[model samples]
Target chain A: MIMTTTAQATKTAPTTTPARSIARLLLHGGTVFALLALIVFFFAMRPDVFLTFVNVKNILFQVSILAIIAGAQTVVMVVGDFDLSVGATSSLAGAVAASLMLTGVPIAIAITVALGVGLLVGLVNGILIAVVNLSAFVATLATMTSVVGLAYLVTAGTTLFDLPDGFNNLGQGRLLNIPLPVYFAIVISFILWGALRFTTIGRRWHAIGGNVEVSRLSGVNVRRARLLAFTIAGLVSAIGGILLAARLGSASAVQGGDNMMFSVAAVFLGMTVIKSGASNLGGTMIGVAIIGVMSNGLNILGVNAYVQQVVTGLIIIAAVTLSSLKTRQR
Target chain B: MRIKFKIAALAAATALSLSGCAASASSSDNGKPLKVIAFTSGNQTPVGAWWVKAVTSKAKDLGWDLTMIQGDFDFQKMNPAVESAIGRGADVILDGYTDIASIGSIVSAAKDANIPIFAMDSSTKETDGFAVNITTNQQQIADATVGALAKTLGDLKGKTVMVIGHDPHPGIRMRADLAKKALIAAGATIAGDDIQKVKSPASGRTEALALVADYLSAHPNGLDGVWVGWDDAALGASKALSEAHSNAKVTGVDATSEAIAQIKAGGNFLATIEQPWPKILDKLVQNVSAYQKDRTLPKTKFEADDTTLVDSSNAANITPSDKLG
Candidate 1:
């Protein structure tokens, strides 16, 4: 039986291997190459401004929020599940935190509540998918719509501003002259990387993602693993929202929602790197960086914002397609 | 038991009829506490918040209960808010109409409910049968900015002046158009191709830096002067100049606190048009109160006070900070 299965796999592998190889190259290599080329182009276009340390710092600071949100998104997508509501969850958390702070809630307590709200949102998503047996896509999409509606209800269609000084530091504060948000992203990514690589729960998520029935039969407790994955995703998303609120010094109902689709695109693109079709933390980080770089570089190049959105969407599609091709090749 | 059932049915019918009559009477009443509903299109941004503050504070003073509804700038939320207010027998409704197209339906609904609607901040020249439309005079703002820029540029008529302004919003577009006309009249060669129209401040600083850098690199001598349509844009442009070491004179309308600070800091920002929010609020209250006293008062159009030019020379004379509403 093993011989027969191997022979069948070998026969199918030849056609798929080339595609996978190409996909891997495009997903992993394309962004770096594009970024380098953009840098060169901008340097030539505006030598004084584009090649400066101040500009680089500015770029990183600008993309820090996207990186944080995209990193959280990467974790969720690893188990072959998507959380559409992450953006709304982020917005809701930020708005709620800002509102609480306005009401004289201590920054720490406000942040805790904001994060708690995110976890609760995640729990709902996990229950809907793992316990109630709903499709991840449908469950998350519903949550996204509901969460956005809830944010509007909370704010009554107004922005929450005049945030406490301490809250602003999370986004603006720098350690050793580096932005606090950048550090926050690094810490979160490392924690996620460690958990996914070293923990049994993380291994179980991958196992269930690869084959639910087999994992279940092998005693993986698939439902629980999926639930845990979703819960973690929610927590991370909430953190992303809080960071955003700090950065902007205010929170509006739809502030985080604008970047939701972009973060998901990054996750999809991330799947094409390192381990094609497998959501690896390293690949996701790279994916986030690529998106950040593109946005930052384009803004530095004076590209129109409308045109920037178009370019971002196209790059994501190209990256994902390349990754799929590489996987097929292998 | 059968007689009791008949009497009970008759009582129920009478109650329903009486309630319906009372609703219609309240809806049409001239002196009955006329329900006034106000709808805004965003969870309060500065502009929306200021409007809310002004209207609600006036409502308190008038001893009126104003129903304020918020919409997330999406028509889905806005439509429901408008419908709910009309349903609640709102006799007079104040709305900041974000979309011009939605005004027709809103106007129709208010008319059907025998309500008079007043729109603030946003205006529809095509709107008919509305009580009054209150908005900032874009021309006056443009004139103020252009006059200031011309004064600063003085005799550099043929020099290329870059106009940085948002073009998507109708109000912004109107200001830009008026500014363009004024620049042409002043004999200044307005560089249309070099014009940078930014949508938001999310990446405003970066965009400003890049545009300024590119313009300086390309032109070598830098722009003669920059005219921004709004205060925030001016702030971004000012940062770009500071970074590029270019001494381009910058002028902007909407004298926000930050803009005033930049002017005070001795940046090349020559002047800013400060819209007197207090005057605007006072006018809004006056018009609202007048309408309340006489429902048949003709629709009035009035321009609020002009922009207060704040250049480095007279920056000290202006109030350092004023609450917007």
Candidate 2:
């Protein structure tokens, strides 16, 4: 809701003009170029450190949770809604799940209950925005505050650690030489990509984003569609929280607390890519990859964290610039 | 803006309280409520919770009225918290902010109102407002911990060490800088201390896991010892070292429970420096109460707390006998 809509994209309308096609290619293609260029730059600077297998794994392992949440953010944005409560929901979910596990609940039950908490938070958000007709921004922002408060209330701001070994393995486990969370991220992104690209529900969501009233007149359940987008956001954030709990081997009031902005940043970067760029899952994945590589590569190069924040601000500007170019092309 | 209203409200209360306070410094203990604003909720961690609990209990024991307001980690929240504190018209205020810079304006306000501020953790050396700053000798603590690292390793000259330190809080930064300096002076080569930067101390485990995973992948076993800024980071690095199949010894400053557990379990952690926060809390409370009666604040600007260096040989002694449960 906070993002300025540059150009209202018409999905499924094939671009016929050559100049338009060229402009679209340049704008969307720049992120791809920036990503590849960053990889090459890091490799050139620190071939032994950056180009190695272990470091590469570390980058992907770092990328997995952000990608998962950003992929969810992509879908939420496509339906003309914003889920600002994503991070808070994830924190609450993680804290509850960890506390439940420590008290001798089965790990599966604990995790399921955590995801269930996410679902309920989503449902409340959906009811407020859809039924009560609250602004998506206000509804989600209100939920964000309450949910964060609930997280601290439940855990009293303590870090819950020493989860059973099975949960640790979920975070650390690898299948077919890839980390477990990486596999989860891949499967989730592709599924979201296919659903957004191929399905009727997905197209209707694009229709809603393009123009909500027109989509409503065309028989789309705009309210229900927006509600579903939020629910998916909740589930995805919960997954992020669960994986983060496993990865860190502990859950705190802030385990996944700083990710909403990262997810939003990724989705906005996603909007600058490809075929009228209606927040595609593919573009969002690319955006997440860019963040992962930049941080890992910079850390490997021993750039100070303060300098790293400056570099990050610069990249966001570059992404915003590309998005403005997309607007100019239209 | 908040300070404006706070001072205005304080003026009203000062009018009301001046008569009571003027009656007698000794008779002022009519159990009139005093206010306490913490950096954040003490319940944020076992140690943090311990601070809150100790203060609350001490207040109850002394028959003093205590109001606890949990501020936040953001430095921006410091002034607003101070304003809220003034609005409450408390006799004395305790400043628990990790950064002393944020408390500067409040200290001025407190001084104008003839209220005393007992700044906790943050060094008040250059600051004039603190009645007494209760803090550790962070540099000396770091030097002792890392100097022991040099002693244990038998020679600092060629041994590789990684200094994992946090950089946000000035007090913590001082300790990290001192640790790094001591390690380098001892002849140890400092490797990558590139753990993720944390806004609050509670998330050290999360950052430590990611940082260690990445760093250990890059430099498998060149490190002979790990010097962390706090015991949380030490505990985290020990876990990471164990995960990566390296047994590099770890030494840190906080005697947090998890770090002690690591030491008792014979993990890579070798030593930690224990800060007696509760004892400091008791002294701060006692002195603040004393000041309230006699209206006499401390002559000393900085009151240094003692820190104990505990290795495996003395890990049990360092264990928190005062359990929260």
Lowest summed-lDDT stretch of 10 residues in model 2 chain B?
Answer: B34-43
**Candidate 2: clashing pairs of residues:** B42-B48, B42-B49
- lDDT tens digits by residue: candidate 2, B1-325: 9999999999999887777445433434566554444443234555666666777777788766676655555546657766667655667777663456656667676766666678677662546777788888787798788877877788888888877667766766777777777777877777764333544465565556566666676676767888888766676677777767786888877776666766777778888888877777778877886786667788787887768887778888765522443
Residue range A168-228, candidate 2, lDDT tens digits = 7888788877789999899888988888889988898889988899999999998898888
Least well predicted 10-residue stretch by lDDT in candidate 2 chain A: A1-10
Tell me the whole-model lDDT of each prediction, alpha carbons only.
Answer: 0.71, 0.75
Model 1 native-contact share: 0.08
Instruction: Looking at model 1 chain A, report the run of 10 residues with the lowest lDDT sum.
Output: A23-32
What is the TM-score (0 to 1) of candidate 1? 0.72
Chain A: TM-score in each model:
0.88, 0.91
Writing each residue's lDDT as its tens digit, candidate 1 over A112-188 gives 99999999999999999999999988999999989987887666555565677789888867788777988888888
Question: Per-residue alpha-carbon lDDT of model 1 for B1-325, expressed as tens digits?
Answer: 9999999999999898677645644543445555678877743455566667777887787766689887756677777777877776765777663545555667777777666666665552535645666667778887877887777667647866777766556666778778877887888876534356775543343345445545554455557777877665675577556545778888877665556767887877778876565566566666656666654544554333456678887776675323454
